[model samples]
Target: MYDWSALPRGARASLSVAGLVMAASFLGFGALVRSLEVGLLPGLATTVFIWALPGQVVALDMLASGANLLAMALAVTLTAVRLLPMVVLVMSKVRLEGARRWPLYALSHFVAVTIWRIAEDGIDEVDRPQRLPWLTGLGLALMSSMLVMTSIGYHLAQSLPPLLAACLVFLTPSFFFISLFANAKFRMDYIAIAAGALIGPLCHQYYPEFDLLAGGLIGCTIAYLIGRAGRKRSK
Candidate 1:
């Protein structure tokens, strides 16, 4: 039997609002999988393997649409490209000096937005040597909850109202923004968030194909330039 008490602080922290929100968001994905007539196993596999909601959704949609394997792969790759920067940020935080490379590589798979956010919020409190273990535990705990919730949502999809099921998918980003605002430590962070909020829709309206990429690039660049100027003035 597993010793629940022995779980790391990061794992224990998973018993919070972040975990619940992640589970809820994935529950909607599970419903989507079922509604698409995809089997539960494939849905659970996406949670375990892809481990990113955007990629999972894209793959499922493509699969349902009977897209060719190469096209599906390319589409999923594009959707997941956004994760590269996130992975870099989280790895920088949790990587130990002179630590073995393989474990960090394994840990990189768990660096989804929710995990990254939780790590950002709590990782500083953990000792360096324990950081990897703490992150491992946290990732596993969250993943386990997601797996269970996904299954539950799959089973419940038939009874769930279509509108309610669709709304559930928004829970993760809603929680993410709330947490981002709560934990934002710099003016630039807020500015970036505001800029993205204002610019994203405008880009979507005019440049629908590359709205996210364009919005993020433009918004963050503007925020970064302003932040740099502020720092120069302060000095």
Candidate 2:
């Protein structure tokens, strides 16, 4: 139902901004790995293979501490497990019945936080058949940009000034926050964001080891409960 020709314009524009932000984010990550003396090749491999920033951070931090292999594996697994809900939500929207399973398997790797937000916001504008291709192109472009930036960050870590490097690292989350606020359509979205902001720092202070997981679970649960109560009261 959709033509590939219509993909270029939107894909190009979206990629321009999103790719740059992703690149900046990974550049900071690469530099962090370099500063930790984690070996350039292994850091690049983590970026390519693990592909999740938070998981990579956890792994690198554990490795630096000379944590046990089992503990590191468990931590990485826990961080990556957060992606499951994201992948499920995304697949529901773009996947077609009777499509080849292999491609879907491949595409699932691209369903990280950034891609999820972009796809969730833009998928409605795309034809059903073309949604996958649009997302595929967007993911590929962002991934490629991050890889290149990671290399730049790793090799040039020394030459890049500390302040500039810090700015690059901050760009990703800043972009994510802006994008989330811009696209928010419901009261629940605001509630979730506010809850996370308030709860996340407290968790980090009290339970640094499990801060991310604890904050997410508690914040999301509270947000859900509040939304449900509001809906019932409205009726």
Estimate every model's Cα lDDT from 0 to 1: 0.77, 0.74
| Candidate number of the best lDDT | 1
lDDT of 1 by residue, 1-235 (tens): 1122334666787888878778788787777788778789988989999999878876776677677787677667866876788888888887767667777888888888787877778778767777777787888888888899889888777777777766654554565568668757778888888997889789979965455556667888999899889889999
**What is candidate 2's lDDT per residue for 46-165, written digit by digit as tens?**
777788887887787777767778767877887688689889988888888777666567778878877787777768987877777777777766667777888888777777788876
After superposition, the stretches of candidate 2 with alpha carbons farther than 4 Å from their true spots are 1-14, 166-235
Residue 82 of model 1, lDDT score: 63
For model 2 the TM-score comes to 0.70
* Candidate 1's TM-score: 0.71
Q: How many backbone clashes does every candidate have?
A: 0, 0
- For all predicted structures, in order, the TM-scores are 0.71, 0.70
Compared with the true structure, the alpha-carbon lDDT of candidate 1 equals 0.77
